[model samples]
Target chain A: MSDASELPVGIADVEAAAVRIRDQAVRTPLLGSAALDARAGGRVLLKAETLQRTGSFKFRGAYNLISALDPAERDRGVVAFSSGNHAQGVAHAASLLGWASTVVMPADAPPLKIERTRAFGATVVTYDRATESREEIAAALAARTGAVTVPPYDHSMIMAGQGTVGLELAAQAAERELVPDQVLVPCGGGGLTAGIATALADRLPRAVVRPVEPAGYDDTTRSLAAGERVANAAGASSICDALLAPTPGELTFAVNAALAGPGLVVDDDQVRAAVRWAFEELKLAVEPGGAVALAAVLAGVADTADRVSVVVLSGGNTDARWLT
Target chain B: MSDASELPVGIADVEAAAVRIRDQAVRTPLLGSAALDARAGGRVLLKAETLQRTGSFKFRGAYNLISALDPAERDRGVVAFSSGNHAQGVAHAASLLGWASTVVMPADAPPLKIERTRAFGATVVTYDRATESREEIAAALAARTGAVTVPPYDHSMIMAGQGTVGLELAAQAAERELVPDQVLVPCGGGGLTAGIATALADRLPRAVVRPVEPAGYDDTTRSLAAGERVANAAGASSICDALLAPTPGELTFAVNAALAGPGLVVDDDQVRAAVRWAFEELKLAVEPGGAVALAAVLAGVADTADRVSVVVLSGGNTDARWLT
Candidate 1:
């Protein structure tokens, strides 16, 4: 295990990133999860990034990345590749920052999110997921226009941006004298987890940070075990579509590998149950992807050890059709 | 119409109430209504009381009521009658204040709410709505034991408690340097509408306050027109079952008569659409009764009037089974 001092995400980076994106984003609330805590055998504090603009935490990293651009690079515009939340974040951030944007999304992306991205005055480039990847299309666009590519994760700016969540969590908790013993964070490309781990490693050096992944796609665990990035095998299954990344990011994996414990996988049933739990108990209509950590805790994936825990409800943008 | 100086609720009361309840209840977010604002030709802010503790603003009043009790009355415990949110509120408030509570609820109350009430350590006294009125049972219980009865509405203490929500709105808006031109409040027994009106009547004296009711049970509107208390025809007719009260409270009606305009009613379809709109657009799972004001806006029950408006989303305890 790497020493806490060596971690790339530090308190200073989180504070600086917070300053950079302070006026550009909303400071979402960190609320108490009494019902979940009762069920999960420890206190649970939820970082409600779902209430963030564009209904996701992607705004943090997106705005963080875009805000760091030089005057020249910002004028050149920015491009991002995402099928959902990140696309909206890039579009919204670019629009607010007065920079033009292009979002490359899959043809199968939800129409509502697509509509929102377009409404934010970003050009929407669609690709057939069966043939071309969104990254490929975004790269091509970036090269053609010299627009900075603001990736969802795997970049210093994005990691630092994501770190602000931890920064906010630290500040909010300090106000109430709450220092959680464990924090279960949902992992996709590991930007959120990496950023959080880096930011909190010092203040909460002993607080265990667990990365939670969907059962069928436990690449973070596998990668962490092997000390490198790992890709999922062919034909995995999951109901958490937002967490369906095929592999872990190289930069993010290294950071998480240094600080994070072994990742845990929660099944579709638990994800569905957590989705319903969030609706009933938390009164939040979070998507399956956002409920994975809460699902893991409720499903008894975490060793409570009679300690208080915090779970980050990363986003809440689920399609209405999914509920139907 | 009553002059601003004569209103019971004032800027000072709201500030004091906010300080009193700051730690006890959630400071539910003020959600911006972009679409609703566009349609209303003005800005709309939603005071999310639906996100309040116990899933309703009732908790605010209940908390204040319990706290206001003399030590002697508090030691004797408390009793309340309700089939819904008030039961939970009384139960939760009693628990918070370290007082014993007995709640008399209609036998037909939703099973989940009943279970939640029971889980909160409040004694449950189930009554047959077909054979016995809950009020009679609660009054008997209070008489038999000398336990104080906290009426859901129509009481000065409860009204002051509910007024705290309006107090919060004024404080939050002032922090942002914005004041609403109009406020739309959901009406059942009229406690919430009257309380909010009382809270804001002084500072924003010219701000129009409109009370919204379910279509088939528009007692507040009728009572206002008749200049007397008006009762609804027996039985529930709208999906907003929580708002299907037989009559408006005498206390609330008197307050609303002075501060509010002619009332508006929304149909069942509008309630469901507002519920759907809340779920889809706002990412909040507000109950049907809680969505009534937004329902009015969506159904165009009120004239736009080109004034910035605020809607109270009063509660969020929807049946979990209903969402699926």
Candidate 2:
């Protein structure tokens, strides 16, 4: 049970999740990319989620959610709607719990993601992109199969799990000789951003939590300003496909809206340039979406003058076809 | 001063280096890439030196060597010869020590490397590749300027410093649930391999240490049987230019010869494929040299049958021009 008045995720939540998933997940290190740091005119530490299970932080939330299921819910299985990292996360989480998982992904999803979902023993339910709404299909599938719907980014367990990143980041930073002044986290549906924000609020209350999103899909930014949820009708016009979400989640928005200072938008060219920089300077294989926050720093969106700042590298599972 | 009995580096030498350089260089995490582990049919842990200072493991040796210098020698500064990561390592180390540094690099060295060394306030002396040898030029510069030459490898301090990688790997593996049965390290002048073997031997006494070398430059492999250092006549033939040393160091060879199980060689194609695999599957930007150990595993060079193994990702700095 989550406390109503508490920050979306507190140190307690992250601490609990850390202990629960300690053996299952990798404790990825926060690495300093010195070359990129110099180019940005400050210290840049990358919390490498690309090295996470299923190659993304999505696994953290998925594992945390699955692990929290009651015995009856576990018996009934779980379902989710995603065409990317979340699909793989749900599949992997289900496999770990020995529970059935049914993932609803659009027919147009990347072949690599589709193949990986199947490899993890999840039942893939594909729907025509033009005719069916993913949410509607997911609801139908859940109802028919008597499976519990695990809505990405809307649940307390998932948010608490993602908060483990912030918890680790705070602990990891304290271990350093010098602490950072700010932390840049890439925002999508707001799960990662909210998680980090909540953890930071409890641990490093003074450290600024800056959320970064692609230029066109600036719903989170606008929503925070209007004090209401704002959907992006323009959709994602940037090169970062992983950040193509139309709007922020209700629960995630509430968490980040109160904690996130502001959201910064970076151009597509900067995103591409940051991707190239990650490859050349940091030797990191980050997806365009994962590189957005770093891209902002490289493009001067944030406080490049800060002595020490961090950019959470959310994941690295990019499609091979994009490289060529 | 290095003990005479050690010749090159021993457990004691590495232990002292570890104590000296512990705060200077990062204790890079030994982590498992889940997809890579599944592919190998064994657990594959990556000691991410790409995440190290100067974007390679060379910082450990460079920092260790520089920090070991007495006040008198420290005033003389340091000189190094390299076209890649080592140049930046020396520059960064010197900068940390408040000493001037002079680096002799081939004119055709990667632009990024040259820029990085310069950014660290090192005086880079470029030499024509067809005319002067980098080593000869560096030696000449050191003699003229009274600067101490910090060879990329071969020196007892450097080897002992590099050996700290092995020490950290051993400690990290022991804390984890599954200890590695074998350790694969990329061998250039045998500094990293020797260091790792000495440290790994002390902890996992029964585990085998395999030094991975590019097929065209398998001097370490041949030297193991010849009972002497074997020099490559057709030097530096591979995309992995970082591992293109003409021969293993005499001191390092002695240490490695005592503990190394076997030397493994993989083709350029294997290294290239592994680089691509790191990018696509693991989402890591690995240079050809850093990918060689993974290449050996992918090409079935290692006995990874349910045994946990650790591969040293020695560096991530690559000539991005090659991608073009």
lDDT of 1 at B75: 68
| Interface DockQ of each model | 0.44, 0.57
User: Model 1: per-residue lDDT, tens digit, A1-324?
Assistant: 776566555667777889999875767777775566678777778888777777788988888878777766577899998878888889988988889999998888778778888987799999997788788888989999989898888887888898888878877778679888888899888889988888788668878788899987999988888888879987886767667788988778878998786888898888888887787777787888888888888899877647878788887778554443
Share of native interface contacts present in candidate 1: 0.48
Model 2 reproduces what portion of true contacts?
0.87
Once superposed on the true structure, which residue ranges of model 2 sit more than 4 Å away at CA? A1-16, A36-43, A70-77, A107-111, A125-131, A177-181, A304-308, A319-324, B1-6, B70-77, B107-111, B125-132, B233-236, B319-324
Kindly list the per-residue Cα lDDT of model 2 for residues B167-269, writing each as its tens digit. Answer: 8888888777667889999988888898888787777778889999998889998898787788987635688878888888887888888888589999998
| lDDT score of residue B93 within candidate 2 | 91
Clashing pairs in 2: A50-A316
User: How well is each residue in A261-289 modelled by candidate 2, as lDDT tens digits?
Assistant: 57888988888887877776677778888
- Say which docking band candidate 2 falls in: medium
TM-score of chain A of each: 0.95, 0.94
